[model samples]
Target: MSAANAPTQSQLEKDIELIKLIRSRGLVPLITAEERPDVPRLSDVQGDVIYGFPKASLNHALNIEWFFFFRIADSGSFKAGLSNPDFKPTSSEDVKNNLLKIGKARQEAKLSGEEVKRVKLQQYQIAFSKTGLLVLGIQDGIADARFDQRCMRDDRVFLGDQGKWDDLFDKPGYNEKDGSAHDVNNPRALHGVFVIAGDDDKECADITEKLKGIFKSSIEIPENGIVQGHVRPERHLEHFGFRDGISQPAIRNLEYPLPGQNQVDPGVIVTGYKGDPVGSKRPDWAKNGAMLVFRKLEQSVVAWDNYMLDHGQDYKDVPGGKAGVNPELSQEDGAKLLAARLVGRWPSGAPIALKETSLKDDPKMGEDPKRNNNFDYSVYDVPGVSAQTPSDYYCPFTAHVRKTAPRNLDPYVARQYLESGSIIRAGITYGPEVTQKERDDKKDSEEEKFKRGLLFVCYASHLDSGFVRQTTGYGNNDFFPITGLVPNNHGQDPIIGGPPAKGSSGEERDANLDAKPAKPFANGDQLDIKLKVPGDTLNRYQVTGHVEIQPLTQAVIDFPFFVTSRGGEYFFVPSIPTLKTWGTAN
Candidate 1:
């Protein structure tokens, strides 16, 4: 690299300080950065520092993760339990330190040509709900209005929930049928959730039982001691048979990101840092902490499979299929292709942006880190494929992944939507694999014992700019990414978007897979959508020849809500030092 391109001496000093900060917090910098802003150490951040435990340090298999939800019965005892030196919550710093130790041991053993010793490992993290904070006398708000709301149940309107929330979301006596809160309005059902993760389920269970015993008097433990969740036997695939956790955001200073992974500022995921949406509005205790959104999303696997079987080939008619004629793909492959379009990726996690190779599930390309996430929406990254299909032709605008993260198209939208609104997801799939009988019947089992879904967990600096905005502004909104483009022809996100509320005025809950450039103007002409915002005219992209005008401008499809919200709660993951302060009475 030339001297001009090389990092400056000041940048090197900052990097050294960043490394020192991490080491001080018992963490090792896995990937070095040329230049990084001063960020909080992993020691102060709770939960998985690098988002979900996709893989363990040195390629160790991640086995299972558990969520232990409880209610604080006695504030004094609860505070005392938190203060107790014996009670140690999982810190990302310790997890990284363990990883570093394992890596070192492996390196030493390799040099000697001998076997390496197995290092025992476990991860633990703790977070409290708004009610949890209230029980501990934290009357001061955490600079997030959405986090401070009465409950997630009440905030469902913003998320477009159709009142299908699970009964567990309700308080002890609240009724689900008639929408009666009873006393639920007074106090939220759950106080907080304790996260325990490791390879050994037995060890995690034992630890959970021990903690329950310790905090028995302080909190009310559920009858089922731990809500166990595990990575599926099918590897990275979720219950619905789709690969998840594929496109996690890479924090600027925290991780060495892959080719096309979105890199965000530390303030996007953690508080009291540069670029935080709330800026200096946060309290001292909330520094290094993050706003956590937890949800129990139940997936109807059989129903989803049936939907795929019935409508998988629907996308064959979408305007820009290769060479303008559908490929001679099998019915099964066709269904799988449709599913890929809906998800914006194949079952193996290969993005549909590479529509040529992605016509069939490209396991080789999906698993390759260098290639899996290498393509932006605008630029087709596949070699030998020179098709310049723009205007949501190759990939739908409402596809789950595109709706969630509209890469390269950020310039057309509001400022900092990608940077400030992104979240660090650390969710785990819950429940057993689907039964053959359920599949045969084309529906989920009526029995509650056979229930399955995701224990969705994510962290961000501010709720409004992060989770809420992404869900409401992008996923749920019809005309998002392009305002006044063919009216409500563009649809809501099929996978994560909520259904329309009952008794509401005309709100079409469908997805438009094929959206061509509206007419009078041809392919190369600028899109005629209304531009009220500044900078909209600066980066207008000209359409390529591959964008064919379809017969119907509003080509809407009724994609059922295969994933339904069972219930959820918002929590605050406080810093380590702030947690220690809870032990002493104010």
Candidate 2:
């Protein structure tokens, strides 16, 4: 209300122009409160903190983006570029300020009866690899083993890359035996990457070129540096035709938690926060920074579709088939059902856990945040459902979602996963949609220049506890969730899971689609006991004794290869102050 603090007319005009630019690009400038969990306070560290990725909804955050990877040539010049206003990365406070300005400008326009226009603003963020740190003389390191591992090329054995690397990532002159680039500081080494995003491709390109020019002497920008990704126009789907970016964890303070969304402390994501694995031992300059995991996963759409079609009619009996019920489904419907079960959601983004028997996508439920991510894969959350928990009777334990986040499977496991194993996914689909020819042929054509895949990007404070664990430990591992159920191993994650085979395509894996607990769970179906109150009169299911599940006729499904990791690297996103420090000194 104070006049002194009021924004000047010029500033208001500037904000309105910003809004218009965004609208011109067909984007909404407003970021949902529930989706901005990574944004920190403006006053925190004098507005020095930077977002690990765009702190907006998936649509807004990745509308149009570019990942420009470069190698350091001159350390002094590269360090100086960090402080250059034109070349520096965008700060978290800058994003928050823009959101506020846009809001204020919209309100002013509404009051003045002026037509409000949306805004699109480009954001630039920087992250450096371990070698980049050494190049910049941060010799002590950030103290993360997985990150300090140096080259993701070496991680191929565990990540299952199997030498299917893009030429750009698999540059020459690396020690083939040890998987180390012969010269760590070579001009071809991946030192750092710059992420630029907005709604304009030309504008993004211009910025990319500008930054390249600015750091021309300090770095070498390869052809792959121009790789761009975009969010599909239809329902925000990925190349796989499924709605993506659902079920992201809610940060404790940054966002208003959605129903059933696991909310963790900022330390779980940003360093120097409450839940960080390294705790206060992290260097002071590394505060507010997060580790970035960048993986380019190429999807074989044709192969996946054919595999689903081939197995669609072979439906598996549920709940251990105790009732000897195997629902007959048409091949068409069966294929859809198979895909949904594999992804743990329909193409519309609805959770298969909530709509287990449905063969069609629930557009309403999928788009409804209040319901889409509200399921916990247990009968305890299903209304009016009487329990005898059958153990993944609805959502298969091998389903992509369940494997990545076994929410509420076990209280301790869920808590532990939320605390350390979670990652903030801000990836965007890269390449192009499959062509009609490719679809008709039931395979991607050799003539097709661009392949379709996901530019998988995620963030976390501890690389080991976050992305690495989710991929190698859970997604790729069998016998996870440790449910002590019969059959022991549930299966590998159907989407991204890789069995313990290194240097292989991971083309085939086993999954228990119809898992059953040796004995039925005691608790009957009821609203989550966690939500129950002392005097609440809600009916609760309580079947005291044990319930037994009979063995199913069909239990395991042979999973096929779908996602192939082309290449990736782990980078450290430093704080604004840290950048300034690096720029001013070594």
Which prediction has the highest TM-score against the true structure? 1
Q: Model 1, range 292-398, lDDT digits (tens) per residue?
A: 88888777788877888787666554445545445555667767877887888888778877656546668877776667788777644545434343356567888
Residue 329, model 1: Cα distance from true site in angstroms: 1.2
Q: What is the C-alpha RMSD of each candidate to the true structure, in Å?
A: 11.7, 13.2
Residue 372 lDDT, candidate 2, scale 0-100: 76
TM-score, cand. 2 vs. native: 0.77
lDDT of each: 0.68, 0.66
| Alpha-carbon shift of residue 4 in model 2 (angstroms) | 10
Clashing pairs in 2: 19-118, 22-119, 22-120, 23-118, 387-525, 475-497, 476-498, 520-547
Deviating ranges (above 4 Å) for candidate 1: 1-37, 49-59, 101-119, 172-188, 222-225, 322-327, 379-390, 483-488, 500-557
lDDT of 1 at 157: 46
lDDT of 1 at 350: 83
